[model samples]
Each structure stands twice: as structure tokens, then as C-alpha cells.
Target: MSGRFQAAAPKAPSTLEKITKSPLFTVGLNTAYFVAGIAFIQSPLMEMLVPQL
Candidate 1:
């Protein structure tokens, strides 16, 4: 009888997890990353910081 117990329900996602899963949040995060990458690639700081491979 003890082995017949049902499995527990999954825990709910946290607020941060919910926010990050939203479409708008995903787009905004991707846009920010893209812009930062472009800025870093265009700036001279990239040359100073990274060695040519």
C-alpha cells in the first residue's frame, strides 16, 4: 500500500524564471547581447584586450 502513493506535483517556477521565459524578455535580452557584441567588435578596446588568433 505504501508503494501505491502518487508522485508529488512539480514545483512552480520562480518569478525570475517566469520573466526570463517570456517572449518579450527573450527578445530584449538577445537585442542587448547583439548590440553589446557589435559595440565591442567595432571598438578599439577589442584589439587592445584580445590577441589575434
Candidate 2:
């Protein structure tokens, strides 16, 4: 019971794997960061253009 309660380790790719897939890796990483920052980071230009409600 106690042993089974432990959490699983996080699985992720190695640095080489990310570098080998450079274009996709960087684009995906940047896109994810940008989207996550949208709500926190304000941009007057963008707000003016789109007119936030």
C-alpha cells in the first residue's frame, strides 16, 4: 500500500533528442511559453488593435 502510493518518475526526452528535432522543439517550446504568458504579459498595441473586452 505505502510502496504503491509513491508517484511515478517524470519522463522526458534527452537534450540530444531535443536538438535533433531543433525546429519542432524550439517552435513548440516557444509557442507554449508565449501562449502561457499571454494573460500575464500585457501589450497595449495588441489590445488597441483587437480591442479587448
Candidate 3:
């Protein structure tokens, strides 16, 4: 039992860890995805509605 507990102890994270570990990274990623989705929605609609000039 004590051996299992020792084995399960948490290890420290190494350097070069991902910036996405932070809340700011998550927000930035979500914002980028939202903007991309809006652009995707608009592009096809604009092309279809505006045919030529």
C-alpha cells in the first residue's frame, strides 16, 4: 500500500511545457476559432450572393 502511494506521487512538469496550459492561451485559441468560423460562414454566402462584380 505504501509502495503504491509512493508510485502515485505527482511529478513536476518539465520545461518547454505548452503555453496552452494557461487560460489566456485557451481564450486566444477559442477566439481564433470563432473568427475563423465567422469567416467561413461569410465567404460562401458572399460568393453565392454576389456572383460577378
Candidate 4:
């Protein structure tokens, strides 16, 4: 009975490598996500409070 658990090696990077390499890209992504999230949260409340015209 000789069974040992071995950890797998880490995988290599793919296309996402460029985003991680640039600070501007990350900032832009964060900003877009923030704006989108705000819009998402507001849309439902707006529809509920405002009558359809």
C-alpha cells in the first residue's frame, strides 16, 4: 500500500496576460465594472418608482 498525493504544477498564462501586465487596462476595467454595477442597481428601482410613459 503506497499511495502518495502529489500537487499538480501551475498552468501557464493565456490571453489574459496582457491585462495583468498593464495598469491602465486594469483601471479601465475597474471603472467600467463600477459604472455598470451602479446602472444595474439603479435600473430596477427606477422602473419600480417611475410610471411607464
Candidate 5:
């Protein structure tokens, strides 16, 4: 490929890469996920899905 027409190498993190490694992003994300998990366990869905729950 000619220099002018060649694709440029990736110089920065893509959207998914940025999100996966972000500290502030994960802090809230992890907290919310944990909270949601707790709520899910206490919800009727848990009993219906896992009869032993």
C-alpha cells in the first residue's frame, strides 16, 4: 500500500479498551453490580430459578 493510502496504526485505546481499564468507571460499575447482585438474590427470581435458593 502507498504511504498516503495506508491505514494508520491504532494510536489510542478503543472504546471497549478504555472502559475496561478505567478506575473511576469501574468503581461505580462494580458497586452497582454488587448491589444488583444482592438485590437479585433477595428477589423472587432467585427462588424460582434456583429452587434451593
Candidate 6:
């Protein structure tokens, strides 16, 4: 525990963090999720596994 070089604590969010939390980020995230959901539901593997799908 002596002479250990510890990293400093995290600072406040930067401009990049502010941009990431913007509405554009929310829309992008939601769109990505929607596309992934569609892909999962329409995948041939899912159809084969469910059989009744």
C-alpha cells in the first residue's frame, strides 16, 4: 500500500458526454433497438426453433 500510483477520480462530464445524453442519442438508441427486435423476430432461426411462429 506504499508508493502506489492510484488514478484520479472521474471529473465532470465533458461536451461529448452532454452530446451523448441528447435527444439525438435517444432516437438513435431506440432505432437501433427496434431494428434488432425486428431482426430477431424475422430471423429464420427463430422460425425454425418456434415452428409455430
Cα lDDT of model 1 by residue, 1-53, tens digit: 77787989999999999998899998999999999999999999988999778
> Native-vs-model 1 lDDT?
0.94
For model 2, how does the per-residue alpha-carbon lDDT over 1-53 read when each residue is reduced to its tens digit? 56676778987989898696889888888988998789545766566777557
Task: Report lDDT per candidate.
Answer: 0.94, 0.78, 0.78, 0.84, 0.89, 0.92
- Deviation from truth (RMSD, Å), model 4: 6.1
Clashing pairs in model 1?
none
Tens digits of per-residue lDDT for model 3, 1-53: 45554457777766535565878888998999999988977897767877685
Sort all candidates by lDDT, best to worst: 1, 6, 5, 4, 2, 3
Model 1, which residues run further than 4 Å from truth? 47-53
Q: Which candidate tops lDDT? A: 1
Worst lDDT run of 10 residues, candidate 6, spans 44-53
Query: Which ten-residue region of model 4 has the weakest summed lDDT?
Result: 12-21
Q: Which stretch of 10 consecutive residues in model 1 shows the poorest summed lDDT?
A: 1-10
Candidate 3 TM-score versus the reference:
0.53
Off by over 4 Å in 2: 1-21, 41-53
TM-score-sorted candidate list, best first: 1, 6, 3, 5, 4, 2
lDDT of 1 at 49: 90
Which wins on lDDT, candidate 4 or candidate 5? 5
Best by TM-score: 1
**Each candidate's TM vs. the true structure?**
0.64, 0.35, 0.53, 0.46, 0.51, 0.59
For model 4, the stretches where C-alpha displacement exceeds 4 angstroms are 1-16, 45-53
Per-residue lDDT of 25 in model 6: 95
RMSD (Cα, Å) for all candidates, in order, is 3.4, 10.2, 5.1, 6.1, 4.9, 6.1
Give residue 29's error in model 6 in angstroms: 0.2
